[model samples]
Target: MLKMMTFFQGLPGQQSLLGTLDPGLSEAESEASMSEASSEDLIPPLEAGVTPDGEQEGTSKKKKSKGLANMLSVFIKGKKKKDQPRSSETEVKSKARPELEGPPPTVEELKAALERGRLEAARPVLALERELEAAAAAGGTSDEELVRLQSKVEALYVLLRDQVLGVLRRPLDAAPERLRQALAVVAEQELEDRRAAAGTRAAALVDTLWRGGVEEVAAERLGARPAGVPAGLSEAESRFLHMGRTMKADLEAVVERLKPLFPAEFNVVHTYAQSYHQLFAAHLDTLAQFELCERDTYLLLLWVQNLYPNDILNSPKLAQELQGIRLGSLLPPKQIKLLEATFLSNEVANVKLLMNRALELESQRWAQDVAPQRLNGYCHCELAIDIIQIISQGQTKAENITSDMGMQIKQLLLVELASMLRSYQHIFDEFLEKSKLLKNYRANIIANINNCLSFRTSMEQQWQIPQDSPSHLMDPLKELKAHGFDTLLQSLFLDLKLLFKKFTQTRWAAPVETLEEIIATVGSRLPEFSELQNCFREELMEAVHLHLVKEYIIRLCKRRLVLKTAEQQQQLAKHIEANAEAIQSFCTQNGSTATWLHPALPTLAEIIRLQDPSAIKIEVATYATWYPDFSKGHVNAILAIKGNLSNSDVKSIRNILDINTGVQEASRSLFSLIKVV
Candidate 1:
């Protein structure tokens, strides 16, 4: 029974015993009965033919055990047969279970899982690195986690390195479009993160490099170079070159380390190089704030502009970073061209400082001299030309510089020339003031004016200043011409006014000789007048003509000769006619003042011919109507000239002239006459 129970429990199908043993008993009761029966029937069954007896009990027990063993073997054999079917059923379930399983992992899912792991591991390091950068930038000490994160990042990189490289090397062309895009995006993001880390490290290293007076250290290193090397590198230039090289090497190392981790299209080298350039540029900007000589500043700027690799400007990424830089301010475009030309020609010795020093000394010499000599335009031109010549000397060897660049240099020199012209303006003003007292005032003014004008002309001719030269450069010369020549001409006109006044007072009727003398003085200096000759001639002629007419009118009023005979009256008439003709001829030859002057002449002659008081009154009234500008004093003078007329008669004539026209008519007319004069 025990053997049967153990065999039944061990069989794959054991629950059948409960059904086989119970017909009316409860299931739990049947199971309990069956279990008890199996336990109590532990003794082996007696042999098939043996009887139970005390003496034979032991032998019977052995025989019963043998027969039970045989029955147990048969039951065991039946249980093995039943277990075979269960094993086959288990095999069927095992085979079907695989078909019920989910699908295989997709490429996107794999990439997502990969990125998750990378970001999970890298997030803490990225956060700690950002904190470290902020601390460094703020001049604070780093947190302890920074060191730990550094190692963690290194370890993470090692772990993800193969995966990252595999993604980078994956053949996207062979992959499905969506999967390829997913992989590419993941790879690019990873590369970007790696580049960011490298940049942060490089920036920290640059900060360390900049400390301890970078310029001083570079100068020491440069001095240690062989004696055969060119000497005299500026502090800023030496430091810039040294720092650039150091930053380049450091960035290159960072790139080399990261190169295998990114795709070929990532251009890691360009990324690091751009960062290096930006770092170097910032360092240069910091150095720029220090006090430096012009030459040293120029050399530093040149090193930034030309000595560095063209890649700095050519790379789109780096170019974007440098867009805000004003390279022209440090070294002007023309100066840059000149320096580049000098370098390309292998004539590395810069004499610009020496040339500027010489120019400054030469400019100072002008201040030491007296008035006119100090204002020497020729000296100004020569100094300017010397500067231009020095610039041009470099241009001769400048195969790299463009013609437009050469023109730009000349234009810049012209601007310098304009600035220097300001110092001489006061000298010209002084000369113009003192010139009023000179006997040869016109000649002195002409010489000075010609000196400046000719100098400008020659400069334009020599330098080939186009008509469209930049207005800033030409404005100075225009101002000089406008102010200096105009002031001088005004002074000459003032002198002419005095001379004409004297001529009117002393030789009123016979004034052609004095007028000729004035015209001859101006005409003799015509060559000096250059562009201003026409204006000077027109103004002088007008002045002389008006003065001559005014003097003739005054002389006619002042004459007090009574006509005692017909011959005297005839002579007076002829003299008046001749004066009128001379004025008319002069007016016709010069300008248009003769319209009123020619009419006045005949009226005055008509008055002289009329001898009777009543006839003279009628003649004077007619003349007054014809020439309304004739005043009461002019009528009185005419009447006084007739020696027969009394003061009362002169007064009566004035009253008649006034009543016939209007009250104060003669006074109003006199104002108009004065305006004409």
Candidate 2:
């Protein structure tokens, strides 16, 4: 107790008060009583003897006396009663309340609070940066201090850039709040950047953030130089293919994921599109410098001109999303033209080489006495099929570039194909004429005829060759068709010539043995007609039919023995009718759909068997209507067979049969293939 009295004696004015209050108690006990009293209850002294209003009311001695009088009064009163016990709750409040009501904070403390807000992401980091910039500009900040602040600001911006890019590069994982904060910072920096300069790119946040994001995505997806590419692909080919596929996928991600996160003013889709387009163009520009292989060249052209535009930029999802955005071409027109020119040059050279190679291989087979392979009884050769496919593929690839380019490629290939086919025909002609084993190669020649027909069809249908087009790609193919048929049928034609020679007066009076011989000869070979492709089989049968009709007509037109009597005319007409029946039956059975040619011989027999000159004239008129293509020369030839007709009668009959008038322009001419003396 006395020791506590000694502690109280140290307080101002407390020594005299404590001595007076307890003379019997020791001074130490009195001091201990005062010491136990709460120090927080004491009034705070004025700083440096200044009053609350900041006036120097008195000297330090006067302020200390005033504080001691207040402390002595409080201590005398407190010593009058024992100290009261405090509750735990009241003790905690007493300890905590003073700090809560403490004096105003310092400037450094305010700064520390702002920094904490920024670091903790509670405040916009860019706002703190802008405040720093404003402070530095306000003056009195030392260069060292400014540099330190600038470094800190730079670190914050860098972190901001990373966050923005992270949002772009991994949008699905980024938080919406973090993304909004990043965009707000970018927008704020953008406004500041625009206000500062007209055309400065240095330290531009928008470019830095957007371009960094796009480049990171491109590099990651496009991948480093492809090491082990797929089979048959060169390094460049593999790189371009990978680049195209990945760029498309990443841009789609940007459009679908990142674009909606940013505001419309940011133009996220267009911005990413342009960045990818420019980057891909740059890559292609580098590649175009080198001499790429054919595969790589085609692949590059495909990406630039076809896949990039059609499959990537204009893909259904991207196109719909980027309705107002105009991301333009992957490469500029001038560069694309250069690529096209290169591709065309390569294709032209390749087509010519392939055509020559096909011709050479075929010629080798001929030289080696290798019989052409037979497929299902039809002769087959790979030359025409191989050559056509090569040209077709080239044209198809060119078409993939563009429709106009496709036409250009087709024209080039058509010329090449025409030239090659001409050479092929020459080779075919040379082989057919010189080859000793002609019978063994007969089926092969027929197959080649079918090949020429296929070539013509492809040129017309696939390449869109017009009937009257100046290219005349059809001319050589037609010649090839004619040449093949002419060579194959030369022997059959010779047989027909000899049999028709038997149509003299004696054979007509007999059982028409010559007609039966002709029928047997053609019927034996009719099974071979099935070997030709269906479309051409009818054509071959028609050719045989026309040949037989023309030969028989030529024989009768010779007027070797005229039927002077009506009975003789009747007998001769019966023989002609029977002959017509046999020929028409053979042609129709052998797949000749030209039933139009079936009535020619029967109609001619009707004109011959008639006795009255007027009746004959009507019959000739009907015959001419059926065979509009029949000429006056043919009518005169038929009149020669009817020996009883006078010159006047023949003239009237000939007048009824006009060759030119009323003939449909599209009519097929059978007599045109025949000649009479």
Candidate 3:
């Protein structure tokens, strides 16, 4: 019981009741009394302190003392009624409200409560947003709530935008290193997005601005113009100039802005410039469709070309497209065709016609001057040179005009040159025929031949056509000149043959005057034959020498020297001396013929001077050794002229004949006819 009283004294608000408890009571009975008391009845009372109405400090203290006494009384009553049975009212009240009981909340439940608190805090903002959306969906209205909501939303938006911009802008200036790195990544992403968006917008804007500007300019330029009539740009020029200047400024601004971001990519600027150029091209095409005047079209094309300049045209990115947009392509098809015809086809045709006319005039002049009476004029046939010069001049003009046309003209000139050579050859042939009738026609013919050769030489030097020139165009000129030289050579030889035949037929007794005439006529002209003089003159002189020597031998054989009287022998010897002198004079006068004739002339003079048959036989044998044509007839004839020779003299002649003689049988018979002792 004492322990129970001590436990009761330790209980809060039960100390006052401890003194009232029966100390003599058993511990079990005291516990029963404490358990019987109601917990509310055991509660402490509130002390009235400061009241709303003004109250004295003593009254406040008395209220606090009365509250303390009431607290003590409740404590005593709760202790006194602890073992007593509860009243029916308290029991009924307890039954009416069952005691509430639950376990403590877990972490998840606490987290859920915190989330709910956050949601509850955001409810006002969400409600305001929903109201704003509803008002917007309802369309614009003067409703006060809607207006208030809109104003609120706008203000909220501005604040949010300022906050976002502030965050974005502040990092670069004030963020720490680590935060700055993160911001850089975000900034890079934003830049890429902006670039992509700008690319698309730029393309669309370029196209839109270009088309609008071009259309506006065109409308102003062509609105009142008549169909098929080109309009003057008095009014339109200003607009065009303005458009170009504006476009250039805009393009420069765009390039300057984009250059830093994409320094290596020309396409950024190329795309915009292409749009501007394409607009200009479209305008040009439209003007072309209206049958724009040549002058206007030219001026417009110039303007476009000048506006674009090499910087735009030669841009590595757009080179191919710019190459396609030349002045030629911008011109109308009809104009282009007309230009080609005028410069290329018509010019070539005109050159060919002029060449033909020049060639015809040259032919007529050649015909008029190449007459037989005007044989001296043959050397001065300026036809070929004149024709070549005219063609060359024409070629120069044509080349200045166009290279292709010049080439055609040059080819035609070559053909004409060949034709002129052929005509010259024809004139020469006619001249050759007429010349055959003249007494000294060979001289005239040689002069004409020399003139032709000289002209050909000059032509060769003047015109150095390449070997790779077209064969058909070049071959005729080459062949004709060569053929002309060959023909002239053949004609000269033919005339020579005729002159030699005439001399041979005269029995070599033709006067020195005749030989002199032949030499003067042909030899004087020899120097003019240029390179051909040596061979031609050598052969011709050889023929003359041979015929003259044969005739002299015959004349010597025919002479009858009667050596029975010294006076008669002297007369015959003098006759032989006169004939030998004539032969010597003829051979000496013509140097080309004298080479073989000179050695034989002295032998003939010796034979005549000795007047001995033995001397004749010795000389004749020596002459035969030199000239194999010397025959037995020559020996017999000379012996016959000597009359009867002494036996020793005849034997000496026969011994000379027997020395390995290989004469013909007919010539041997003449030897057999000789009577040798």
Q: What is the lDDT of residue 323 in candidate 3?
A: 56
Prediction 1 TM-score vs. true = 0.31
Query: Which model is ahead, 2 or 3, in terms of TM-score?
Result: 2
Give the total clashing residue pairs for model 1: 0
lDDT of 1 by residue, 1-677 (tens): 11122211322344433233233433344323322332112112333333432112366555543343333223222333321322222222222111212443322333244455343322332232233232222221222222222222222232333343333332221234433343454443334333433333332322232222233333343334333323676555556656655554444443444444435544444544444454555555566556655455455545556445443343443445345543333334565555544443332233354355644664344333312222332112344445455555644433223445345445444545555555444454565565455554444444444345544554667667654577655665555555655654564556565655643366344455655665555445434444333333344444444545665555556553455565566566776676667656755565444354456666777776676667777877777775676767677666555565667777877776665564334422321544221
lDDT of 2 at 438: 48
The TM-scores, one per candidate, come to 0.31, 0.69, 0.31
Best prediction by TM-score? 2
Can you write out model 3's per-residue Cα lDDT over 1-677, one digit (the tens) per residue? 11112211222343423334324443344333433432221221222443333122475554543443332223323432423432221222222222223532222332233233221212232233333332222222222333332333222222322232332222222234433332333333233223323333333432343344334443443333333323555444544555555445545644445433332323435555555555655665665456544335434544543444533455444455345444223345575444433444443455456656755664454444443223343333344455556656656655553456467666666665556556555655665555455544444444443344444454556555455555554454444444444444554455544554543365344535544564455555445443333334454455445445554444445443334554544455564455556655654565445465555545655654565665677777777766554445555555554444665775577467667766444421222322322
The whole-model C-alpha lDDT of candidate 3 against the native structure comes to 0.43
Better of 1 and 3 by lDDT: 1
Off by over 4 Å in 1: 1-235, 238-271, 278-423, 430-508, 511-514, 528-677
Ranking by lDDT: 2, 1, 3
Candidate 2: global Cα-lDDT?
Answer: 0.64
